[model samples]
Target: MDRSPLWDTFKALPDTFLAYIYAEKTRLAMAEESRHVVNENQQIVAGFHHGYEASDDQYHPGTFQPFMMKGYWIPCSEGKLFQLRQGHCSITRTVEGQDQILYLVHPKSATLFAPLISKYQHTQVDVPALALSSFRTLLIALPAGGTTEFAMVKVSLNEEIGGVRRLLYQKECAASVANSSVLKNKQTEKFTCLEENLSFVPDAHLIDPKEEAVQLSGAGMIHRPVPELFTTQGHYIIPLYALFGINNWPLLNALIEQSQTTPTQFITGALLRPIAEEMVDHIYRQRFYLEFHGQNVLLKLTMDHNDLPAIDFIYRDMGGVNCRLGDVQLHQLPEHLRGHAQYWEPNFIPDAAVIMEGIAKKVLFNLTKVFFKSEPTTRDPEFCCWRAKMTVYGYQENWTLPGADGRTDNHRTRHTPKTFYRYGYFEKIFARELLEVMTRHGIFLNIKRSCPDYDYSFFMDKIGNIDSCNTPCVEFEWFSELVKMTLPHYFQHQDAYSRRKNISVVRP
Candidate 1:
């Protein structure tokens, strides 16, 4: 890895400053002296003779790949070459004799990746090109170990709404977290771990000296201080559609078999129960609710004490966080973080039950039950019974809200006047349905049920001309049947929306 060229360019700039960032790299290289290479039937063969994990045979590279130099460039749609803006340019070459990709970003964009480029060049001994795509002529390369899996490159087709501006917002949000009190100090091991897991995308700058930028379309240089953090890797994290797809059978089968043991279960039980409990606790205690969607929720694997594969979870993309407006005790937080807590406003505070709705729809129904329905091995009554049992267990163990007096709360939160009045009949019915299913599974036989006694006829009687409006509760009703089935029925309703909605997710 060479930094002389980039460093020289940086030094030549008129004004520049260092932005503190964190990077880490770990690797194990085999001894060159012990390496063996052979030509079998004209195919090059090489193998590791000594290592923790040894292989008998591996493909050997027969060609050399060169790094991109100062002059190489990717041409725009109009055939004009993209030039380096400021000192923000990176060169990455493949290891096994592949094409080199050059990333040239505006000075503003560079801040998001500079620390990463420096880390890769220093640690990996080569700035390897990752799976990155750019809509704006200039190529972009994400920092290694960062969540680049969700990176997407698409043509902006919306005529009325602006895509670039939205991306800028995401950038600003990520930068906000990066510059927050918790991250700026970077003195603790937890912060180090967080840095390794998260990737940031800062607001992009339009660098069209000739007035020809792909995303900007000739908009002059603009600077925004927005940034976004992406945690889950798109490839490793199972997509929400994978529930409907057939290719997920293998993983589903494995998880079903593993579910017999509490430590190894992937879908529900021990793995998901505690996390859901944490989410509920966060909402009541910290007023922060996470968007637990399939795209946001990743299925990760980690080894347990016995060295068996067990499920783990990672959360990122703080832009989806739902905040509640109220007084919060911030004296315990760092001096800088205390100020930030006061500045942020609650943007999307839904009925409290919506949080549980999202968790159950995504984790319980979409991720878990869909697999059993799809896979032949797990589609039996036994699997359904298992799923039913786990559903009750999960809610009882995690979703219980304690009253101020401290008992089980006995579903008091669901029946509160404030909740029902604020959210209307839709939320009330949804909450009742959830409670009924849990009760049917024998979750709260001992505690007096607080679910309002409302039957299907009650809903039918109340269903007046209110169906004609374009509001959230009515919109939710269109797929109430699917909700009754405990699935993400809202997705079906979303499909029929008259106006387009942006449900953006990260990708690599």
Candidate 2:
């Protein structure tokens, strides 16, 4: 609970900034606390905790574990260090006498992996040092309400292809130092292989933390913006939006001024492109989906040789990622960690599609709304034009009046243009762009059937239902045609990019 070391790192920042972080953290904690309170009239919503509902009864009930309020300290090979409670289960520790950091997970706190840990009797699991370093660095760079320590020392680009860069950062951890006493006696089973790099971010689980034992967590390489990677020119990382308090408007303005690019170009190229590309690549190659909302995503801005802003993204919180199981080789995973249903999905396309929708609605759409100064909902001329287009495109039908017998009669039709305006121009545009991106990546939209036939009745029933509307159908059809026209060229470009960088082709 002693966060002095972490707080000291932010000494360069103003006290008001620290106060903002504290206020934000307190507000978030309060909000989470309120959400966890279930009234007597409310039903016990299963799997609501951390957005995961247990498919099996053996796991902890949904009513338990209220927002990771508890933090535990573990005795490791080096010694006992203070646990820095993050928003979730993971914590960071500084390695003494070395410039390194280790990310450790309290397995019990991670609901997804808790069953596996209990079944295997594992003591502790090691998160990727690089990933942890990246996570820690990102936390410092974009100080949210959680733990803050300058864990990352330096970051360097491991590889770069087609403007996307693979970053590597170093941090200091106590476990990274070799224990001569344990090494000489050959009792190294309790020590983790700190140097092993693997793909896939794991939900680390542990048992009996007081015991002196360390186990390697499920391993895999994760790509994207994380932690501390800086250039000699002092390039810094900032979140697309703050976790609390301030907004990204000023930052966006500064970035636009510095890059000398219009807001549209910067947003489309720097923000949307990276996110869409990463999502598509992850689904296609890695067989996983990321929650690329504002908080989980960060922007790495630096000046290029031409003084234009070179933008990259860093994604954190691997525990929330959903993996596709059917295509993923489970045999490649550790024996103990195999067959967990929480993270892996047999049919993952729907989940991935939903995540894409979230990015559009939660991240891009809101961002555009902020940038354009557009109203939340508009019933203006543009909206009317969009509705007309939807009707012409067969996504909406002419309104039919209800008959005296309380049935919809086809004979009597009325075109009463209802003032139902939930989407603005920017929202529609972003939705269409998202569909285009999905189409390019071979992900076509498949709207579920709320009614047997998706007809006028369906549209009427879902008039105000933003989540399920006919908008996607219209956009999908439009983009599908466009993609069809450019199918050959798209494949050619994709193949060329793959050939240009083989590693980038297969990486997330």
Residue 494 C-alpha lDDT in model 2: 48
Tens-place lDDT per residue, model 2, 1-508, is 1333333444544443333333223322101100122225544321112222222221122111111111222323322221112122123333454321232222223443343345433334322121122211222232237743222222222233223332221111211111111112222221111121111232234322331222232221212222224222345454445321123345556666676665556666666655556655565544555566655554555677877887766554443456544323444443333334234354355556556655644454345334333211232344445445544544332222223221221211212123122243344455445545655755331211222232222322332333333433221322222323233343344445556697776788
Model 2 lDDT, residue 102, Cα: 33
Tell how far residue 6 is off in model 2, in angstroms.
7.1
- Give the top-scoring candidate (lDDT): 2
Steric collisions counted per model:
15, 21
lDDT of 1 by residue, 257-309 (tens): 64554211333343454454454344433445556544444334444565455
The residue-level lDDT of candidate 2 at 406 comes to 18
| Worst 10-residue lDDT window, candidate 2 | 29-38
Candidate 2 ranges with C-alpha deviation above 4 Å: 1-6, 9-233, 242-247, 326-328, 341-343, 374-423, 435-508
What does the lDDT come to for candidate 1?
Answer: 0.30
Write down the lDDT of every candidate, Cα atoms only: 0.30, 0.35
- Give the TM-scores of the predictions, in the order they appear: 0.38, 0.43
